[model samples]
Structure formats: C-alpha cells, structure tokens
Target: MNPRATPTAPPAPGPDSLTERYVHAVTRRLPEDQRDDVARELRATVADRADSLHDAGATDDEAERAAVTELGDPDRLAADYRGSAQQLIGPALYPAWARMLRILLLVVVPIVVVVVTVVDLLDGADAGSLIGGAVTTALGVGVQLAFWVTLVYALLDRTLSRAEAEQACGGPWSPDDLPPVRTSRGSVGDLAASLAFYALVAGALVWQQLRPPVDGHPLIDPALWSFWIPVLLVALAGEAAYEVWKWRTGWTRRTALLNLVPTTLFALPLAYLAWSERLLDPDAVAAIQQGWPDFDPGVAHLVVLAVCVVVWVWDVVDGFRRAA
Candidate 1:
C-alpha cells in the first residue's frame, strides 16, 4: 500500500440524514398525541423508499435525496397531516365570515366613535382628551373585533371539518342532531356602546396613572398603584375579552353566567378599597370636605361600595334577562 494515500471519511448516519430532518418538520406541526406515530410512519416510508432507490444501484446520498424529493415540501405535507387545515378560516366559511366582520367594523365602529365623542363632550372632556380617547376606543375595539371573529371562524372550521370526517367514517349524520338555536344576538348599537365604555374606562384608568389632572390627584387609590393597577388592568382586559365574546356569541346562557367572573373581579377590590378608606387620597377627600361641610368620607365610601355592588348585581341580572 502507498504510504501517501488519502484516508476515507466515515459515512454520515442513515437515520440522522435529510429524511429524518424532513420527518421532524412534518411531525412538529402535529398534536403531541399523534406526533410520535406520524414520525414513526414517515421514517419507515422514507427508509423503504431509500432502500428501493439503493437497490436500483444509486449511492446512499443520491437515494436519500430522491426519497426526500418524493415527499415534497415539508409545509404542504404538514398541512395535509393536520386534523384541521392551516388557515384562519377555510374557503367554505370565508365569505360569510368576511361579510359579517366587514359589516361590523364598518357600520358599528364609526357609530360608536361618534356616540362616544358626543358623550365625552357632554361629560366635559376637552378636545385633546376626547380625540385621544376616541382613537384608543376605535383601535382597541378593532383589535378585539378582528381577533374574536377570526377565533370563532377558526373554531367553526375545525368543528365542521371534524364532523365531516366523522360522518365519512360512518358516524351519525343528521340535521335533527343539531343543537337548539339558543343563541341570542345583541344589537350592534348595544355592542358598540359597551365596547366604547370599556375602552373609555380603561384609558381613563391608565391616563390618571401617567398624567393626573392639574387641579387634583387621580381618583384611584395611589397606595395600591404598585400592585392594584396591574390587577385592575388585567381585570379590565378580561372584561373587554368578555365583551368581545358576548358580541360574537351573543347573550347565551353560558356567556351570561361567565360574565360574573370579570364583573366580580372588577368590583370586589374597588369595593374593599372604598369600604376600608383606601380608595381615594386623604388630601382629595379633605379638599372635598372643605367645599361641602356636610360631607362624611366614611359614609361616602360605604355609599360607593353599595353602588358598586348594586351595579354589578344588576349587570348580572341583565345578562340573564337578555339570554332569556
């Protein structure tokens, strides 16, 4: 043997080859329950194909490349493997969904803005605050609208597709099996008004924290700013989410019942704070007391707590009434 001959490199791993990478890409999109089985099947298929190519006298690299090529694009294969197609809303439902969403955003949103602007003007917010608040409400409502509509349609797509698959597999299929039409649609005006009110309250809460008015400290409890503000914001977000859910599904009994969670969260802390005399600044209360000699801070706090309780209880009752 010649001493100067080149040393050969070891062959790359068969299982750790491009075929394995392609299989990994496909399985990762699948659910955890099915991923292992899908991955196993894909690997076996790739291995069998590569072996066939090898039998035809192709080298390992060539056979592997040909096998992978036969499988095609990973994303397309993944879409095929998924129980539900990778889409926001499928073609079958896109038209109705798009039409509904378009109408909601176009007709409902402007009316909301105009109505909010009028209410703010009546409440005496200046030009800057009014415009800012309106814009915030529009943006928040728009985002909520798009998100919820898409989510509902996506759920529908999955459900309808799954039902079709089950029927194909000899599962029961009947119009008579459909759930009762228990859905109750809210008026567009009502939905828009509720959404605007939520946006206004949330914006006012944050605004006070960032920039209190020139004459007075914020109405919110300053002592609780570190913790309560974030909690309040989360509660506000939850309320907004509920409003969107209500808008999408209407005043169903389930939604009526679920409304209590956010309502309770929003009211409880404020009620506690008011009753415990932690809700407002002492300085602000003194200023108010100076103007009104008969003012009693203790009584005022109790009144506020009572009002909050009443409002929330009424809101829950109203939800049930609407559902009925």
Candidate 2:
C-alpha cells in the first residue's frame, strides 16, 4: 500500500472567510506534515484577535480584516514559522551568499574541470587517468570554492551592521520585492546538465586525440590544435559562463541576444573547419576510404555543417522563446 494513500481523518471545516484565505496562504508555503496544525493554530489566533477587536466595537468585517492585516504578509509570516529568520549568514547576507555561490559553482567548477582535463591530456596521461584526475581536481576545487565563499559571507555577516548588510544586499526586502512564482526558464538542474554535457564534449575532444593513430595521425587534425581547437575550448568555456549567468538572471530579450555570441563562436568555426575538410585527419579519411571505399568526405562535411546550423538556430530560438 502507498504510504501517502493511507486513510486519515479529514480536517475540521473552517469558515469560508478572509481568515481562511489568509491561513491558506500561510500554510500552503509550509511542509505538508506541518500545514494542517499550522493552519489550525493560525486560524485560532486570527479568531481571537478578531474577537477582541469586535468586543472593542469594531464590526465583524472590519475586525477580521484588521486581524489579518496585523499578521502581515503571509509569505513573510511563513518564513518566520520556518525559522528562515535565523542563519549562519543571516537573512541579509544569505540571499547574496546563495546567489554568489551558485554563480561560482556554475561558472568556475566546469572551467576547472575542463582545464584540468586539458592539462592532463597535454601531459600524455591515459584517458582513465586523466578523467580520474579531473574528477578529483573538480571535487577539490568545488570544496574550496564553497568553503571560501561561505567564509567570506559569514565574515561579512558578522562584520557589517544591519544597515550596511541590507544595503549590500540591495536594500531591505519588502512585499513588493517578492519574486514571482518560478518558471522553468532557469532551473539549476538544467544548468548542471548543460555543464555536464559540455564537459563530456571537452572530454571527447581530448580523447579523440589519443585514439589509435592512422599513419601517425589521430582522428582529428593535429594542425588545427594551434588555433581552432584552443579557440573552440575557450568558446566552450564562455558558453559555460553564459549558462551560469542565464541561470542566475533568468531569460530576457537582452540575454537571448547575448546567447548568440558563444553559440556562434562555437558553431561557426566548427562548421567552417568541417566544411573546409580540415576537422578530420587526412590519414583517418584515407583509412575510412580503404575500409569502405565509397565514403564521401563532402557528405560528412555537409552533415556536420547542417547539424551545427540546426543546433545553433534551435538554441537561439529556444532562448528567445523562454524569455518570452
């Protein structure tokens, strides 16, 4: 039997009134297990307040409205109930800390991984060794990033006055400053997945160089390593940073336009390389010819070009669509 499906007594009915609406707003933000109890307690408190006001000669409607107003914004009240008001970083610095940590993790971690992987690749390490080294380095870097960022924020929280902290965090928060309900545009999971995908791509680019050589040449042309490959790697890093910024700021028309820079930087050069038949080693091409004898490199180039164009267009379009 499903635990969630287990039978339980229904909640006692409350009046369909202003207090009910206020209670619902507060309790809805609470954990499911706590909601019923919190809702009941909140309703009782509101009733008592309203009763006192009514006894002081206010009408029922006025008393109820005043009681609810006295409780303040339901969202803020919910935060208090959840004990979010207390923290190592405190409320003022917590938001800034979280945002900075997210940016650092998203932007810095992947770059560190890619750089470590590339360095290991250049050092002539085997694929397994390089991959393991990259993973270990990434973990170390991540821990350091988290530790330092937290320490700095904790120091700031301790050192700054409340007014200073509030100013640094973009002033004291208000009901008007409450964020809208979240949408799917800037999901952390999605950003992580994208970074992981780029890391895999970087790994693949490095691994291809270590493949069994055809006439002492890897599958990818070594000549392009001087410029094209390095530029591509830099572009990939830029793309990763862009993903982090997008996740931090969410989609917007300006960001959508900015997205084109890294997308084109990656796609156009790759397409050009593939189209000009410089992407793959000539010996590798010859080996393919020897095996199949009918392999047309032009067809391969066109396929690559088409794929690049399609992916580039789709990414740009999706950004604008999400922003909208």
Candidate 3:
C-alpha cells in the first residue's frame, strides 16, 4: 500500500507573509485612489493562480511560490502597472524641474549680469570687456544651475522609487499646503516706485553726458563721468538687488545687515565728491552763482552733502526697524 504524502505547510500569514509583502510592494507605488481596487484584483488573481496550481497536484507552499514567481519582480510589476519605467527625471517631476529652471534663468541671469558688469567696470574695464564679462558669468551660472538641478532631480526620482505616489512628491501636497495668503516686506507699488526711481536717476545721468555742452562744459565733469558714472551704476545695482531681496524674502536681520554694504558703497563716493568740492560741474555751479549773486556755493554744497549722509543713515535704520 502506498502511503499518503505528508502535507506541506502553507506560507506564513500577516505582514511577513510573501503574498502580503508582494501586494504591499505593488500597492505602495500606486495612487491611493487606485490602490484598493488594484490590490483586490491582484490578490484575487494570485489566489486563482494558486488554486489552479493546487488542483494540478502542487502543495500550498509550492503553489504560492510558483504564483509569485510567475508575476516576476515586485518593482517591475509595480512599474508595469503604473506605466512608468525607470527614468532620469520622470514625467511626474519634469514639470517642477522645468518651472525651477525657468525661474532660475530669469532671476539669476540678470543678477549675475549686474554683478559682473559692476565688477568689470570697477576694474576700469572697457565697455567691450564689461559686456564680455557679463556674458561669461551668465553662461557659467546657467550651466551650473542646469547640471546641479538635473542631477538632484534624477537622484530624487531614483531614490523615491519605493515611495507612494503622493508621498514621493516630497510630502502630501494639496491645495491646503499653499500659503493662505501671500505676504511680503514690500508691496508691488513700493518695488515699482523704487525701480522707476533708479531708471529716472540713470536716465538723467546719461542725458547730462549726451546733451550738448553748456559753454564747452557738460552738466557733469567728463573726467568724473568716466570714473564716477560706473560707481553710481554699481550703487544703483546694489540698491535694486536689495529691493528685490526685500520683496522676495521680506524684512530680516540678515537683510538689514546686508543693507549696510550698499549704503556705504553709495554714500562714500558722493561724500568724497562733496567734501572735495568736485561733485558738480564748476561751470554749472558758476552759472547758478551768476543767477543768484547772494548764494554761497560752499554752504549749498555742504547742505547737499549733509542731506545725502542723513538719507543713508535713515535708510539703514529703517531696514533694521522693519526687521524687528
């Protein structure tokens, strides 16, 4: 008489079981909306396959192993169901990456151009050299931004492979995740006014040089124009940068500290010109004196210099007070 074969033990139950783990592997990568339905279908399919194998004379353990093996790697199965194969930066993250790149290019390129141009000009560079330096700086910054941003996203895509669809987005992102209402240190009107002021000052300075000379003397000393104009542009650029920073980051102790550099850079030159009695074109001053015989030019110059200094001090104090 042939003895009956000993019954083999079925797979373990609970989280440690092969079936639950495999199901979890697949479902974790799926969206919550699809997870329940897909899990049910997957479990049903696996059970049906196992039962068929059991009827074909395979034991429970053997059937379970065969069924899981037939489905192949858990990761591959998840990818297949999601229809997203491995990618450097998947479709899920491509839009974010593109948006970031656009913002960086728009913001960084202009800042870099301003900085490079200022540096070159301060070094007594020719116009050609200043333009070339700006271009080079912008190109370098662009390449660095592209490379690092892409590399980071690629790493995130690969590392977040096992995360749930929503979880892989870095967090549970929802409409509620957005700020309730936007707030800033400065308003749009303030930024616009500041920008307009810079434009007007720059235009006025340039016009003085371009306009016909008054009695063989320009509104500004041409020699001072060659040197001081660049200095003024640099100061203007620094102030513009601070305005942008304030608009974006709002007031902060850090911003207040940063304000010191630009104010000092701006005031020092104007203060020097005022003290040395060379800020205005002598001919222009003489013409003014001719019109007002009682006017004391030295006193007027001292008053203007004092006003500039006071303005700078007031600006620095205001920045810190706002931060507080």
TM-score of every candidate relative to the true structure: 0.46, 0.48, 0.48
**Candidate with more favorable, higher lDDT: 2 or 3:** 2
Candidate 3 lDDT over 122-192, as tens digits, reads 56799888878888888999999999988987877766654443365545555533422346447899999
lDDT of 1 at 294: 87
TM-score of model 1 vs. true structure: 0.46
- Best by TM-score, which number? 3
Tens-place lDDT digits, model 2, residues 9-28 = 12332568888999999989
Alpha-carbon shift of residue 297 in model 1 (angstroms): 1.2
Q: lDDT of model 1 at residue 276?
A: 89
Error of 2 at 161 (Å): 34
Candidate 2 TM-score, C-alpha based: 0.48
Give the top-scoring candidate (lDDT): 2
How displaced is residue 57 in candidate 1, in Å?
18
Residue pairs in candidate 2 whose N, alpha carbon or C atoms collide under 3 angstroms: none
Stretches of candidate 1 above 4 Å error? 1-184, 210-214
Provide the lDDT at 67 for model 1: 89
Q: What's each prediction's clash count?
A: 0, 0, 0
What do the candidate models score in CA lDDT, each in turn? Answer: 0.73, 0.81, 0.74
